[model samples]
Target: MAQPHIAKVLVVGSVNGHLADFFAKVKKLDARYGPFSILLVVGNLFANSDDHAEEVISLLKNEITVSVMTYAVVGDRPLPRRVRERASLKSGEICNNLVILSGQGVLQTSEGVKIAYLGGRYISQCLAETSNSSIENSANAAEPTDRVAVDPENSVSVDKGNSTAGNNEEKGTAGSEISKEEKGSAASESINEGKDDTISDSPPDDDESTHAHFDKLAVADLISQVAAENEKTFQKAIAQPSIDILLTFDWPYGAAATSPHTASDLSPPSTQFASNKISHLCAAIMPRYHFAAGEESFYERQPWKYSDRISIGRGSSAVPHFTRFIGLGAVNASRNEKQRWFYAMNVNPLRNISQGTSAPNELPANCTTNPLFRFGKIARVLDTKSLPRVLSAIDSSGGGNEASLSNRGGQGKRPPPPLNYICHGCNQPGHWISDCPVKGQNKRQRSDSSPPSGYVCHKCKKQGHWRSDCPADSSTSSGHASDALSKCWFCLANPDVDQNLMAAIGEEAYVAMAKGALVAGGSAKDGFHGHFSPIPGGGHVLIVPIVHTDSLRRACEGSDNAGADQRLSAEIDRWTEAVSALFAEYDCAPLIFETSRCLPHVHTTLQMIPIPNAKAESVKPALEDLCKADGLALAADYPPAQHDGYFALRDPASGNDLFLHMPKGSKSFNLELGRKLAARILGVPAREHWRQCVVSEDKEAAERDRFIAAFSKHDFTR
Candidate 1:
């Protein structure tokens, strides 16, 4: 009876009742324990009374085998009242093979005194529960195995080779007894509870599946929230100067299924119909933005930037409204480093700014009334697919003065120049249509930005010199020294002698020439002759035809025509009429007469000069004044002084000797007319013959001789 009862009264070793009691008292605290391969229990179990100990052991043995171990000192009472008293055990009752004790000297036994310390035996189902009691609870509330068995439900095999005849029969009966549903439901409940507990108590898993679902959900939710919040913001923004909504989606975000997917498989939020559908849906619900998912980037990792193309009033934030077009690009992502909020916005408020108030930092103010603004309209018209219809509409709407469909700031009175996408006028990349140099002016303020390479020679299609700087190309090169244009016939024979060499040069040198040449050209449409005409006193009515002297001589001497004189007269007449017609049609002023008889080949005659610095409002009146003095109506022949102003200034005392008055401090005494002009204008003295002279240095003589020789080959003078 004692053996069977003791087997039922199993021990919960290593865990003391005091510790368990303390844990039980603090049961409200969150206690989390889970399946682990190792467990270290630290406790003294001797503090519990025998009755309590017996009860605890019963609980332990119901699920697992039990062992009783004790660590007691000799000085301590052998049995306290809190635990079983020494009188309760018989003298020889202590079993050597059953319990383990540490630091024991002796145990009172009926037969003899014996030593006991740190010794124990394995227990075989000492605390095993009866089958009836284990299956008493419904499977719904059942727990996972508590004994840490490899396979708890199939525990009959844990003891190894010893065959259980009764266990086989028990297993057969257990299998037949339990239905599959019962096991499945119990397992499912255990797994669900484990998962829920894990999620609440532990760090979330960082698996790919988890992140993918999270990202998708987050993006969708964010889109919805942003749309809702910004809808009202967008409405208020519309009443201000400019209103543009930009939507960009990173590639590799959607379209993952269309093809064997790589990073590029993701398209930008499609500007196509599908994207518009999304936008429309959003708009219908909240009116958050006008458009979403605009055109995709032409390249990966790039997005399109947009401008409204509006001409907002000066000092107003309206410029952004009209400049709205997309700039699609793939810039390096490295540019994102050191980024800041309010990056390009004006931090200061502009409440009291007036229409013409100077923009901060000298930037051009946004102006509602500017000629460049009107020029943008022309660009917009050209940009749209329906140019013809737009043109018709423009013509119907009073041609150049058409009221803009939108209140874009375009109160300009002058027409813009022809299309020039890359404007070298200001020596900067990304030119506006207005920035182009055309018809005498570039709209932007000029800068002294020079190309890395030197200027270029357009006549020879060579670098290092501009046409103005090419002696063989034009008279300007003859006027200076240091770097003389080569006089080889091939170089000299280039047809576009007067055309700026900078325009034809390599990009680097060409840009340099463009910068310098245009600056001297006075304006885009204006030639580089100077403020005064090449031939002074020539009025706006003069026909300034810039012709190559050699070409003129060839035309004069060629036998290809029936009459060379007649051809020459006709060519001159044709040019004369063209100039007149151009003036009348475009309301241009007049051409001046500034011819150089010295250069026989290609020499430009002063056609006309519009009233110098004519205002837009006064342009018509100035043209009227010029037309009233039209060359056709004036004397058919120019006066002798007009024809030969330079020779007219020759010394009267010694006509052939030409004892001319040279300036006092001339730099070089040169024979060329350009140097002579330089000396006269600069108050420099000369020191050589008209054909072989020097003003200040021999550099001038060398340069003049080079130019004269080059110009003479085409002079056609016998």
Candidate 2:
């Protein structure tokens, strides 16, 4: 296969009104990373003062030469009058090669890279205005004012109308610089300012052409437009839309904390300015590369993974996808010569990549799980109505409906199943009755009174009888027993199982250290002082039943021999108790939870995390809070009588066992809910997902050895 064509691109930080210097640097960068396809500016393109007004006018009039196609988004500073006027034109093309992307929309480059951008800082007024506007009005609301421009004088007011006065006043001192005494006095005044900051939501004056914030409804409308375009191009609803790049002026919430780099790299005030709205948008879009530039520092986060599988009910594809986030620094504003003002890279558009090949071959060891996974469902809900055709198609196929379970049990009418609903003949969701995979084979078998030429029984490994009809052994065929034992990650018989992480082996169950333990292996200071002095190798482990069962309920009820079933349950319970006792020895209590799904070929495992004794009282309330936030009902019942799937939590500190029963055929129950709740309670929210806490294989082996040594005395099976 031929290699995909790579587009060389440059992403720069704030220009800060130094147009001449910015262009000079770009020229040099082009020489080095040569003949770049395009340039993206994320921060303030123009300075607040009029020092570079001439350059701005020159660029607007196409007098200055711009070698590569350049696009800039609105930043914190107000745009100059001339530049704003030029950008307000229909095309938003300020010069021959330079363009200002004034509003929230998707920009597909000549190279086929789709860039979804929402420029400008978020303001509450934009959302309020959007709520009152009609869909048609919202779609047409992408104006020059949509870019957030903060006035230096009235920093509190986010309304674009308020900036007009400041813009007129700044024109008077255009060519002058602030005196040292005045600068010091201004700094002192700002430091002593009160905390009663207020934003104005008054309607803008007719002459006020500049706006300070992008409308939330405009972003939703943009997504709807993209979905419509995709349907026309591909003739199907894609569950996870592919965006090559996403550009925003403000950083997404938790971007710094979830990254491998410390949040300390960014100033405290900058980190506090991160936007939750941006986070939700990023989650919904799942962009391959996200770039932001509001902070004073430059930090490139390690790549993070997000699920790319098509949601075709059960047995979906297992392809992996990853995203990289880079935050650049201000241009010509170097501190100790360490901050990176620009970044260059080669990128291949998602559409150009071959079908079977992964765009990104492998994830780095430091890669983290999707940080925005928690907000994905909520984001999708916010724009469901706007995407009528796209979402309707998804609902028909049972793909993207996170609330399908709720809809089914409610008084509302259930949605009609897709035309290509699960094939009864093949027991799969891939095709309809007329196009079943085994239709031809069944006809040939009947005529010849024997199995078809390509027939192969999966259960008995014979030529006769379909795999589903094979009478070799009912137990062996049920629950996908043979397939589960061979391919399951938790089954010890699988060659891929990480034996190095296995801490202990029992007759009916086994215990292994979690691949990525929530807690670090060291003394816990800061709040956990006396309660948990030292955490031994994260103190996180998984207790798994040796039998390959989908759920504990199945293991308990699906067996012919009641005695054997009871023993299996008892052995798993014993392992949990032993792990709890071991953690208690180190002044820690265990929070064990299990997500038992009624799906085939699943190996159930109970995850245990040791929390500091001092923080034990807060665990129950935290779990309850998560349940409420996620719209889950918490029941006081310990073991549910129904054989349906459920999420059960055991809080040893409160002596309370709570369960959240999932409706049958529900695919929206978050399997990582337990880990997320635990991370919040432990005050380490970044490690909610195991991928964020993954370490080296050597480290895993060492931790396993330490856990085994400590667990030896409590080894009940031995």
Candidate 3:
């Protein structure tokens, strides 16, 4: 139960085939620093060819006696053949005490320090060759280029056969940050130069150049990947911004070129291709210690504070966060050389806050829900006096001057809860109508409703009814300010998610056929819903809470210690467990997925899919590869008690679950990640798109009916 000790991590810039020299440096460090916990290699981790492979292999095999764990981001060059040949299929160990952190993902050391990595190299090649390039061009002035003496023996060319190797890599990545003129020219240039290459170079007619657009798209994808896996990290970076250590291959473009090895004098053009992608990303993920391995000489900049729009005045300054950029240089190539560029970082888990002596990293001592450090502390704590500007913009009472939310019934009267049953009007089982007691209501309500003959309701006609007398209740009658909440897509009473699609409805949750299911449809003769070819596949189901809410993260977080919220919590747990049980009954491997944009009115949805065993095994790796390309960290492990804001599912094979925590309700999030992954595994990538699989209305009805027939018996609500 002792408090965990700080981890000493060594951050090495580039090891351009300096195997012998690197080992010598390690030995010196062992003798000097004694025992570093981790050696994080950032840039060129391997020699391109076998020129230095034998020596490096020998060192890895025979001389690495220290227990220092090693990890690396992929460099511009492909991994050395020897290492790749012996590497685990994905993120497996390459040698003793060394595991190549494959693709973008997160892992926790036994010390309990969480390490989230987005492994990628800089795509801006031109920025490396000319100080006058786009990034440097934007700088005010550079004056310390000559202070660090260059070493001829330390040339990185030893690994790639040329000192200009940094500017020559683009095999699998789009080169970004070229001069604007070059970008424009590339867009209009004859893209057919590489006509024979696997990817076409033809530029789209849009103003952006083809290659430039590709870089932008690529960087956007990377940001999206990060958002996908660590949405809370992105938001936290914006709110209560603080990251202990951040590792990237290149510094943000506007950062002072502090490295004496980089040229100080240069004139740059007005624009560059996506030059601000990294800068914008950094601004959001405000790191306390930002380390980059792009330059050849070490440079350290005093921490610079950045003030964002959400910045609050703290201790005399309006600053939200600050970042200290440290640029590391390559180690020596020869046997006995050392360089100042290598960094020895000391990270104490409790440096910023209170830490007790008796607590381990897993269970930090002196812990309370210390409101001070939680993300979004600044935004949440703002008093009304400080928020006039923000509040003025929100329509607090009515849109179109409808009744107030708190007084929907006028004069401070709370509106009745939207009918809990399908319909409150005629007391129908599956549908809600204003006059449910009307003649022939029971059997008529069982089917989809259509407005009465010759009647055209002017208001709320979208539901196929006349406006004034439409089935739309007063809650959704446009005059009600709570219309949005009442008409929430997941609310059972909403016209959009009627009981027609639900087979099993429970107090807190419901079971419905997935809109874009992944599991293939089969014959009902098997005691399950048969195939719906028009809909692509059929076994997908959605286990959702009956009420409108954000994500599982929000649902659980907002639940209070008060007994009133316990049912909400219980309902969530019941639905989750029931999802697993349902999947088990069908002999299917349950792979669930969801992402929320944090909109309270938006209900959280979990997709439960069953895939073939072979396909199921491929899901994680496939996702990891995509995340790697985008430089996003996907976490797969967590300690149960600490699992907050995370979605987790245990793999039956390993008996261990994978957990990923991110912000929810992002409009950009694809809710169909499960379908997409299944598509990859099932060899139907085209159908992976959510919109592509919609079938005709009749077919959909048939699919839904079949699902209801299969699942109605399992309805726990009854």
Candidate 4:
């Protein structure tokens, strides 16, 4: 039999139906051809088109060697078109060999991979921006020297024009960095290579494959649809359109706490909010197509491809699992453009009924079992036939209306998944005790309820027990350690003896996690940032005022006063000047961050630490120190005196430790003790506050050396 000549072609188009159609044909020709070697398809292939690209890649790899590598670069812009002028410049990247056959002629390389860049200006722009930002970010990253520069204009290349076919057997020029062996295989005869050669000029025509592709596309479409529906629901709950849908990979499941939401949601110290809806959700997934033993057939490829296929939707229809959209509007807007901040105290999932105070015999109305509202044990599994129906149900008229309750037979229905099932002991369906295990448990001790008991312990493991009853640990201790390594009244708050004396214990935990890696060296293998950075403006500091809930109301009680109290205003101004001066030393400008939405007993301030030319990683520690350092210095100047006892005496030799001679006896020390000391030092009316506590036994030399090693080498002046 005569051998048919193989041709490598480059296809440029929107990567949706077209790419699927092209790959479908290749799959059908699997037995007929040794391999379809020369192929490069490029387009806006992220987001929706990403799945389609995977299918094409899978089909190609099955018949080819692993040496044949494929590349998919997300264009700098959104799909359909790309930005050419601003295309990302990936230096030293070459797509050398692939045989090229086109409408024009058999041109360029006869055995090489064809590299193509599809789309227009926007995509190119996105690519360029991403590449540049990456490089700049690297340069400003913890490892600054390894950053690379990309030449945008000259990044993409393709051999062009017409060339002779049969007469010219001349070797072709390869552009990209493809291997010689793979190049040889591109034009090799299928039968000669001892491989099947069944693929003809005709394209693929298989109904089953077509259906599968359609199903994949439908799934992608459904994700977007569901996302949109959820957004509207989120907006109604928060009374704002700026609510963001964040998917938290590590949030723990917990019952509702007190209504911290109503007490002025100023980041923390303020109580966390409570939502009426159920938050914890769990669901079982079942596949529609399960193989019957007698009917199933085993094969290397044929039957395996047709094996029992899985689909989505394993949970009950009556109680659909929903993800919560945390309203980030107030906090997001309050923060300076790109200033970084950490979430201090996290809000645990509030239960439908109050914990501890609730009765064992009766579950909250939201958690009770009602036939119309309860999900059936045997849920409908989604298959190709059922998937479309579910998607329609999610997007249809009934689903679009936000107020139209998903739960049946009442004015109130549990909102989503985590809330649907409660603990068996507590009669809440959201969690089963077997799986309702407490977090931070010993690896071997984690277990859930066989018998539904309302009493869950929150201590030792800190799950169901109150803070007062928490098991005492060696490391846990009371007291807020200020940034300056001075221990004050805040440091003595912990009952656990093992706790470190740090104001921001969470931040301290983060630093502990990053201990051994080289903190300042650069590596080529590390992610690259462009020569320029995306943060356009120079670094700046923002000073925010913190007012107690009582103080704010007293000041605002008068009808004649329409603005903030004079004393609070004066304090904010004084802090602003001091903070601005400090930022100026680092070549950064200071901006004030203040909000008049004052709540009871809560006084908080926000500071924006401008990094200017600082690397992202370096900024974290620097700013953290700045906050701590500022707090420490402020503590030193406060009214507290030696006898007042707010400040802990550090040995200076034992860094970040307290010189605790004895635990405070009730008669020995009281709230007035620290307050009196702080008042003596600062000549102010302020009490011994947690924020002003000095961290004792701090090793300044070691910390200073760490800062020098971590950031001194970087040119922060830029």
lDDT of each: 0.23, 0.59, 0.44, 0.23
Task: Provide backbone clash counts, one per model.
Answer: 65, 2, 18, 117
Q: What C-alpha lDDT does candidate 1 achieve relative to the native structure?
A: 0.23
**Quick one: best TM-score, which candidate?**
2
Which 10 residues in a row give candidate 3 its minimum summed lDDT?
368-377
lDDT of 4 by residue, 1-718 (tens): 3221223222221122233333443333322321323222222222222333343232222333222122222222232111111112111111222222110111122321112111112111222233233111111111111211111211222222221121123222112333455434433412223212221211234321100011112222333333232233222321111111111111111111111121123221211221101111111111100101000011000000000111111222112222121111111112232111111111111110012121111111222111111111112322233333333322222232322212221222323336555453333355433333442232112243222245443334324543223345222242221221121111111122111111111100100101111111122233112211111111222222222222222332332443555545444444444434444454433222222212222232333322222232332233234335323321322122222222222111122212111122212222222223323322333322322221221221122233323321231210
Which residue window of length 10 is worst by lDDT in model 4? 298-307
Write the residue-wise lDDT of candidate 2 on 1-718 in tens digits: 7544455667887877777657866776666555666788988787655455666655554556676667787775446655655455424555555667766777766555667777776664344333333111011111111112111111221222221211111100111222334323322322113411311122234443233565455445455645543344322344334467888887876565544353225432245346656765676666778888867457776566654342111123333566677777777666333466677666666555423232433445666655554334322212344354322211222233222122331112434448668654544565543445565334213334445675666556667766545676444366556665677888754645665466666657778888767765666444243212255666788888866767776555656666767878888888888888887887888888989865556788889888878878888888888878767788876345545678888876777787888755444456788888888887777777665566655466556656655776686633
What's the true lDDT of residue 359 in model 3?
20
Task: Look at candidate 3 and tell me the lDDT of residue 390.
Answer: 18
Measured on C-alpha atoms, candidate 4 has an lDDT of 0.23
Q: What is the lDDT of residue 592 in candidate 3?
A: 66
**Which segments of model 3 are wrong by more than 4 Å?**
1-4, 59-67, 88-90, 119-242, 257-275, 307-320, 333-339, 350-718
TM-score: model 1 vs. ground truth: 0.18
RMSD of each: 38.3, 19.6, 26.9, 26.2
